[model samples]
Target: MNSKSHVPFIRTVKISERSGKDTIKIRIAAFVLALTAGGLFILFLGYNPLELYGTIISGAFRSKMAFQATIRFMIPLLMSSLGVALAFKMRFWNIGAEGQIIVGAVCASYFALFHDNWPHFLLLIVMFAAGAIGGGLWGLIPAYFKSKYDTNETLFTLMLNYIALHIITYLRDGPWKDPGSSGFPKIARFTSNAQLDKVLGVHFGWIIALILLVLVFIYLKYTKHGYEISVVGESKSTAKYAGMNVKKIILRTMVISGGICGITGMIQAAGSDMTLASSVAGGVGFTAIIVSWLAYLNPFGILLVSFLFSVLEKGSSVMQSTYGLSTYFASVLQGIILFFILGCEFFIRYKFVLTKKGGK
Candidate 1:
């Protein structure tokens, strides 16, 4: 007992390589815990947590109109999350989805505004093509720099988002500004032919989202390029050692990522907004990141997460009106859920150990 009193117990955390099943269990548990915590917060606010949750579910699903609105919000989120998931699978941070979406919407609007007399189907095809090209090009920029010079893609892509926003702002305020508007800065609306029609109360994009989910799942699971992407994501050096074209893979992956986001933009313009605007993306680009991550980059899993997000978004209005909660409260709850889920990953990957001091 040399002058030091030995502590009876000491605890430390250590990493554990948990199995996939175990990880999934932890994540599910985390979700349940997060909801419980959120309910406590509601109770603290003097509201019945059960009623609030019931209202949220009913508000999002009680009627055809409410359900349709939820689907409407889910389309863009599903598409955007799919796009973000594609790049995330390759470990490339393509955060410029906002800019890509803006570029896409702008390109689609250009055609809609100038070629309104074109055949309806033809214009639709061309508009979609223009959006994909614009977004692909914007995504290509960051990839080119990263592949050629090892630039930081996170910042580059993020900065490009603002650049794309300003570009749309200029168009809305200047050349493309609607003269018919009462001096308000707004882009001209697309003609009826250029706009998308509803199918059973949902836009046709819902079909596209479903099809893409299947295709993405197959592509990732059964393709050579997909294998290459997995290898590169696991380790670039290993990919290079295996003779894979790492740079080409990165460039190609980003294009697909950005191109998908572009399609999402076109959907926004043609299916919903029917016009281009600086706020066209609606921050869905960032939200898509959360969706993609929460789904662990699983294409099918994105559908589930996207629907959950849509419920929160659509139900927020109900909360605001019925319970006098701030409209942003939904966002706050969503953030807390995400935080708890992510933090749970830490516990999933590690465990705490307690031992007597000075004991082996």
Candidate 2:
């Protein structure tokens, strides 16, 4: 038998190089395809696709209040995505952002609950620090284990999320439960001084988020620490040969990553929720992981992606109300769009080749 007769008709080859413009073009095409596919789905449902799309857009930004709601949704997502991107850049899968956020909120809540009489600005600053420290410490745990024993960070971090949630349950049911809640399990709300003030009708967390964005961008692109992280991500062996302390970098970077996520918890509790709850994290940590990856770990890209995600989320509710669409239908549309966008990433890194019959 001739081996030549066994040749496959198609093969996938790695893309050795792709220009920025080409990559952008591919993504844009994917988005168009996604919209077309979603439009077909809407048409099948007895709705005008263009009108439905217009509703989605207007639902997110038709009025100042609507836009504010969208921004509210984006705030935590953008901050958490930025945090996750830092760990990802170092090739560390920090899946514990959810846990870190919870722990940070708990830590911040302690101050807000106990020190209500302190000066407002000073207290908020302190809560912010406490949250950052708590989150950083939580993140450092998995980093330490990974450095010393080479444990699986993903499972370790995931399990920690459950533990953190249970801790909140405990506090709500026992120690920190509001005494005046008449048998309902709940935590007390923060005082006015403990709450975050609004700037331009939105929580001041937006300001903090923007600041962190610039800082993270600078840290990732400019600093010596950033260079070390890049080297470690590419090849730990190479980093070691260059006299970089791999363990230290892992520990430090995780702390920073977790700390940023912790700030999200603080912002949510003080700026949005007005009290720490079991739902303080609100699954934003997990969603931020998708946002971070979708943006390819670029901070500015994260800002854009997070905003789009918020728009979809807010618009889905509007669709449910205005068009009588089921929540499931809205979800299906979102899934289709995400599917195409993510699918395009594959083509960016590789190409499919068709072989000629009887060719070597």
Top lDDT hit: 2
Q: lDDT per residue, candidate 1, 1-360, as tens digits?
A: 676666547555667688889888999999998889999999999999989988888889989999999999899899989888888888899888888988888888899999989999999999989988888888999999999999999999999999999999899889898999885789888889899778998879898889878888887889998898888888999999999999999999898889888988999999988888677898999989988998989998899999999998888778778988886767677877889899998888677677854764
lDDT of 2: 0.91
Among all windows of ten consecutive residues in candidate 2, which has the lowest summed lDDT?
A: 326-335
Q: lDDT for each of the candidates? A: 0.88, 0.91
Which residue runs does candidate 1 get wrong by more than 4 Å? 1-21
User: In candidate 2, how many Å is residue 250 off?
Assistant: 0.8
Pairs that collide, model 1: none
Candidate 1 accuracy as lDDT: 0.88
Could you tell me the lDDT of residue 87 within candidate 1? 88
Model 1 TM-score relative to the real fold = 0.94
Candidate 2 on 1-360: residue-level lDDT in tens? 976566678988898879999999999998899889989988988999999888888999999999999999899999999999999988999988999999999999999999989999999999999999999999999999999999999999889889999999999999999998886799999999999999999999999999999999999999999889889999999999999999999999999999998998999999999999999997888888888987889999999989988888788789889988875654565567678889998899999899877674
